[model samples]
Target: MNKPQIRAHGLLDLLRLVAAWLFYSSTIFFHGSYLSPLLVHGYPEAGSLAIYGYMGVNLFFLISGFVIAWSAEGRNWTEFAAARFARLYPGFLVCMTASFVVQTLAANPTLPYDPSTWAANLFIVAPAFNRPFVDGVYWSIVLEIVFYGWVAIALFFGVFSRWKLQLGAAWLLMSVLNESVVHSTALQMVFITQYAPYFAGGIIAQHIVAKGSSTEALLLLAAAFLLSCKEVTAGADWMQAHFGFSPPLSSLLAANVIVYALFGGALLLRRRIAPTPLVLVLGGLTYPLYLLHQKIGTLWLNALSPAVGRWVALAIVLTALLSASFVISFFIEKPIRKPLISLLLPRLNMMASKLRLDRPA
Candidate 1:
């Protein structure tokens, strides 16, 4: 049996940290309404800047699709599912539990509600029923699960069995359909749009490997850097007012997909840089940080606005939450993830071996 190696782009992780920090700080600075004892007004430019930074989540999804598809290449569906679930669920469950407990304490107590809502959150399927969001971040996980199901179906049909063309087309079509017809930016983004391009990008990178071209990786890395800085709505004051392209799905997708592809390439190219253990640790902490940031921001913004000033308070809170998230990921989340995976993997491997062995021999 071949032992598996864990791979991720440390540089991308660094970029994610920057964006996460920027987004929270900028959002609080920009939105006075979010600040407790709120100022009635916010700087419009700051608001727009914060919104632009929110595109980072799309980049995250793309990177996820690329990495999972790249690493799980030629692996069985069970293995793929196990790997994704193990990486995503443990940290997510902990965060979800924390959010529910917090929300219950914070929210109005007069409303009648069922305990099953928390149960649904545990399964990560509460979004399907239009349940009230437990945390702002949980919605993204629901969408990610939908994306995973789509990947599983593609794998089931032996899509990756050939070269990556059919897989690319399938993802592309899903993206186009989501963007043009389904017309739900939130749904498309969460369910498929953002991930498709990243998966395709990774497939392209993998193809370059098969063809023995090193420049392919370099080009992708450069593209990622360029795309990350692309402000999709830059100088859109007149256009935002006159054109009325509310929500800006096409523009957002354009920026996000490019960024995702670029980062996907950078991650693939990291073999040359030889990332340090600390970089790897930061990369591992990203998911927990992603989950906790917004809720922490919301609470801090609400609690500290009058005392510390909105923007100043936001920066302080974001820093503390990020530090806490790192601790949680390293100590609590990582520990749980390793043991769960260890316990489950052997059973999965045995099952896979049996299925493959029973096929012929």
Candidate 2:
């Protein structure tokens, strides 16, 4: 394979970060005012410009798949899992803790903390098991975990080696049936279709990287899809009507694909663009912004909306979110990432060695 060509997608990732901030800020702005035109009841955009952010999450998953495959190509699956846990869990736990603390302080007197419920969030499994949307953004994290677990399982069963195409094909079929399966039992119906593409796209992108493919055209297409795609309104009745198949499934699939493509395109761009310190720094802050902003936004909306104009409140919240996310990313997230991985990797290796020795194989 030829040396991978670096593109300008890093810059695009930074731009996406800025876009997410604007979307979220708009959500807060619109939601705070009953008269705000953007606030349509039941539409996700009613709360924030998260229709865009949802695509961004798809991009994140694709990036994860691409980066993980590229980074851990020949490594043990356990190490990859550990790396992901270290990358995501610590920040998640911290943010969840902060959310609970704020909730305890700010909620109506009648609202009480349920330790059992809180315990579920600490493990990041609550959202997966039909639990309430704690901190709102946690649902995506749960999905991310599910995606990772499926990938790990695929790797374990040697499905990845024997039939990569078959794996994707199977997932696509399940995704097609996702809506129907939801009726039987949402718990057992793990349709891999909705998510497999993002990861698969990442894997494909990695191959492109390895082959030194030019990504300019692909990147442009992704940008167009991301910016121009239709958004689902907060309380869309279209899904309720169900036109033969679920429109929810169609829309969800579309949204996920658009986002995945955008990220794949971004990867090509990341290498082509000149490295800039500021852009890189902002891009790095995305995870913390993602993890912390929901709680921060909720708290800010509750505490500050009364005193300031809706627009002004929105500005303040956006500023605080970006500022705090950067602080956490640089000071907390970045620092701990390396040490946590370093600490965990050795213990995992030791356990793996012990298990190997204990077993005949």
Candidate 3:
């Protein structure tokens, strides 16, 4: 099979910016009101519009499915594991620590700042330690890690590439049953039942690109898209129950359609979008921006809004966070990732060899 022609383009970065700024920063952060009680909250019309921004998380999962599949191709489980660790851990450490310090200094009652919580968050599964995430957005990172673990396991068993379609179909079926019928929290959490469609769609997308589309692939993609539209509404239901507001069902479905369209457009236009330095920089900063944005930005808003007025305060917070993101991406992650990978990969490979799983790169 031909290697997937996945290329680095700025489109996904642009989507990340939308997810960070438009969805989380502009809409849900303010709309949820759980995190930022101090901000102005009388604008129902605006809140209605902003509620759809939550679908950015869906967009992220879709992107991850494609990117992770591409990254896993032809690599053994250890290499894939090492690469994913190198990619995720350094940035997470820097950003999580930054969040810890900021939340500590701000002393915000809404954000956790306890040392135990901070220590637990260091592992990125704070809930297992009975501590909350320093930032609520870290929940999605955990899901991404779970997906990566499944991929690594699949690679280990030598079934990932060969059985992707069958696996995706089975996963989709399980997602449907778990979400709509069984309603099992354990399944939802362990299998990511609610969001499986997006990931499966992304993997199918990668498969289509690499192996060329088949009738079966197209049908599965369509099924995944339709299921995604159905599943994203689960977020709206939660928001409605908690916040007493959500985008109209029509709006939610339409937004999912639009997000899927954007993904398709990005794929179709990947060749047209050059991997320019500015583009790379924009994409590079996305992870840090996502990591550092929510809790820290809200604290900034709560602190600065009373003084500078809300709009001005938001601008200031965004500007500072963007600058911080750039610094972390360029100065911290770029510098640390390679050396960390170099130091870590061989150890992992040695362990793999000991386990008799090592293969030539």
Candidate 4:
């Protein structure tokens, strides 16, 4: 077997940091009044503006598509599965437990903090068990896991490399059909129809990086971009139904354009970005920050805002969350990841061998 083909780039790390900040400062603080009324009582206009920040989630999916493609290279399905589990589960376990503890202490009505809920959350499919996530932001994590599962299946079938474009095209078509005409909850859950375009765009981005651009790739990318733009508004519609207000359609469209531009720029400039330690740290902290920010920060704001002021409370909460994320990433997650992978991989490989899934079909 050859070494991995894809190289790490700091630009992607920088983008992850940007996405985390956008979600924290804009979506959680301003537009998320529906989740926590206290956070947005006096910031209606800001909420409108900040609602555009939800595009950060779309950015995440695009990055995931690219990174996961990069990761899947030069590895079998077992290795891929083990690597993903080691990468995600440690941070998820630590952060989810922390959030549950904070929620329990705060006793926030909006956030649940029971032992059963916490136990269900350990699987990242708490909703399937009829429990809420410790943090609402975890909904995206579930989608990511589903995407990973599909990628692993593709790898096992030996189709991911041979039929990449064909699969992507089919996915894009199904996405359009499901979102526009089918509107089936089961399809949305299974295929992730609404967000398929962004993921396809990311995968196409990685293909360009690896093989250089071609007519088919560029055309597929363009289709993905257009579909992404169209689907992004669905989020706004959801906000309107729930929160009674959402960012203007023009603002949403503008933000979508900017996101794609930024992603494209990052890919173009990746060689120059130099994967520095600071950049790696920023990227590493993003996951923990995303997991820990919303519910814990809201609970902190509920306490601190009463004693201090809202702005001060916001500053304090952001600083604390950043600090906690750093600690979790460097101290807890890093140390545990290698050992966890080492322990899991042999077992995973053994199971794969028994099932004859260690080799691609």
Candidate 5:
């Protein structure tokens, strides 16, 4: 129950959001030819440089673990679920719809809209439904949902608070074994074994804030870093194999290490972080910006590049995305959320309560 006192500037959250935009945006830079003029003839460097941005996603997972664990305190499963849904789904639905529209309308569309795929993306499980995401970012949102599911299950079992450290530690170790020994798709899906170390680091961060000495946090942080390093190495291998750029494995590891260190250091210095209403607005824009950026932003880049120069076109698109995200956050998403929460939450609470009651003594 010892969460931050709701200050003005979430230094860490802002940091995570920036990393998300930087890394993911860079990936788009390489994967597509939006900035072809800026790249060398073969675009070799772009691929390797963009690979490091993948760590930004891991940074997000770590932050989510910490924030979710901190937020879940002093709430029943109903409250937790409702809060998460209200915060995530309303904004997501708005952005996803916008993304669908923009991508569908683009002159040379990247993902041709299949009605089934768009519908599946509405549930954030396009692949499971044998369809594709309208936007690629939905994959990470799916992981966050899976993590939330496990956390909810833990809450229901009444083990989250009492056994968090042990649970997190075991999850980290399982990730190691899962990668090396089994390579089971089922295990990966169920536990999110690939990203568990980051989540585990988040949980351990909460423990550091709430209970443990800095030394303990440091030790657990070391374990998570070592495990996460393996994933980074694998990513390097994958990038080399598929993308044809062998970014020095050492550079990739160093970049990932810096990301982990920044996150851990933020936890240690979390007190200095101020939380303002602006934090919510910045946080709000991040998701919408992320959702709308890839397909549409690139379209904008392509469309405007002929008229304007490439870098100028890129700037225009970035500005447009930021403006669009702000509009979605304040005008559409925030307005829709209250009504949505009001309509669905009571029913959700009743169902969760019934489930809680039905549990055998």
Candidate 6:
């Protein structure tokens, strides 16, 4: 029964930075191919921390749901669609291009761009074209797009204006079925079934935090956490099947518990932090950091290891990659988003106006 109260939230923004740092350190420090040369020399295996780091994507989905719901207040379906597009696509295009260029040049890159795969990935859903993502990290982007699509549909139908909790609860129930019962690839693809709990968690968080607290939101929040806990076991099975190795189930469970705690605890303390521009910018850096950190950071490590020694190389590379992401967030993404919104919002408003269902009752 609660409506979204959109506002700038500093604590949530800072938590996003934490998730980004977790994933970034896991990627760069663990020394996969981008880092193997340095890692092979002496870096310790991140072990359980690396496994836990995988759940950072879950945190991202949760935060995104919260952000979208908050941002959706007072906006028409068309305007919502435009804002989401401008927020994501321009930076994605630039980062993908940069990733492609870097991967092509790296000696042992994982995301070598085949023209077809690269082209398909430009849209963030290469699977739709029957191709793999240009980089492994892209699967999250696909899930995000799918989430946006469903929300946009709700907007089109004009129900999202008043039905946020009902829709979130419904999605959470379906996600529970998808995780516990029949495992359907179709369900997973369209509904983002495996990851729905996290998204639902964000939605629940939004309802609780933005609209003031309520019992319904609390119960759904508990359900979402339980479902996410279930995913830890499933994720272990997945890793074993594909990668020929699996971390201990206890380790996986512990990691999930820790992340859910961190995320949930942070949300609980949202008002304790001040909403500052620097914190907000740190939040903005997460997207570019996520995009740039993986293969590129590793590539830098590989190139630098013998010349600088692994540890020193890691320090330099981490500093540089983090700075690059900061620069992209501050200069590229921010500057472009403002102009893009001005140009696109009017057109989207027109499109949504034509949809009879989109009109407010």
Winning candidate number (TM-score): 4
lDDT per residue for candidate 4 within 153-222, as digits (tens), equals 9999888877777788899999999999999999998999999998888888888888788899899999
Q: What's the candidate order when arranged by decreasing lDDT?
A: 4, 3, 6, 5, 1, 2
What's the C-alpha lDDT at position 199 in model 1? Answer: 45
| Candidate 2 residue-wise lDDT, 1-361, digit = tens | 1133133244444545644554454444333333223222222335423333345555655566566555444445566667788878877777677767766666623224567657778788774544554576676677777777776666555455345444544554454355235533453235434454555556545545554544642453343233223223211344345322223545665655555455555555664655577877877667767776655565665566577754566678778877877777778777898788889877866886787621110
lDDT score at residue 116, model 3, on the 0-100 scale: 94
| Tens digit of per-residue lDDT, candidate 6, span 59-95 | 7787787777777767766777788998899878888
- TM-score winner, 4 or 6: 4
Candidate 3, residue 254: Cα displacement in angstroms equals 0.4
Would you list the clashing residue pairs of candidate 1?
Answer: none
- Give the poorly placed runs of model 1, Cα more than 4 Å off: 1-47, 108-114, 154-158, 181-195, 206-272, 346-361
In model 3, residue pairs whose N, Cα or C atoms come closer than 3 Å (at least 3 residues apart or on different chains), thus clashing, are: none
**Model-by-model lDDT, in order?**
0.57, 0.55, 0.80, 0.82, 0.74, 0.75
- The residue-by-residue lDDT of candidate 5 on 80-167, one tens digit each, is 7777888788778888888887767763345758677678888988888887888777889999999998888787777788788778
Query: Alpha carbon lDDT of residue 185, candidate 1?
Result: 74
Which runs in model 2 stand beyond 4 Å of their true positions?
Answer: 1-56, 108-114, 127-133, 156-166, 179-192, 211-261, 356-361
Give the distance in Å from residue 129's predicted Cα in candidate 4 to where it truly belongs.
0.8
Using lDDT as the measure, the top candidate is 4
The Cα RMSD of model 2 versus the native structure comes to 6.6
Candidate 2's displacement at residue 295, Å, is: 3.7
Name the regions of candidate 6 deviating beyond 4 angstroms.
1-9, 29-42, 45-48, 107-115, 243-245, 354-358
User: How does candidate 6 score on lDDT?
Assistant: 0.75
TM-score of each: 0.72, 0.71, 0.92, 0.94, 0.88, 0.89
C-alpha RMSD values across all candidates: 5.9, 6.6, 2.6, 2.0, 3.4, 3.2
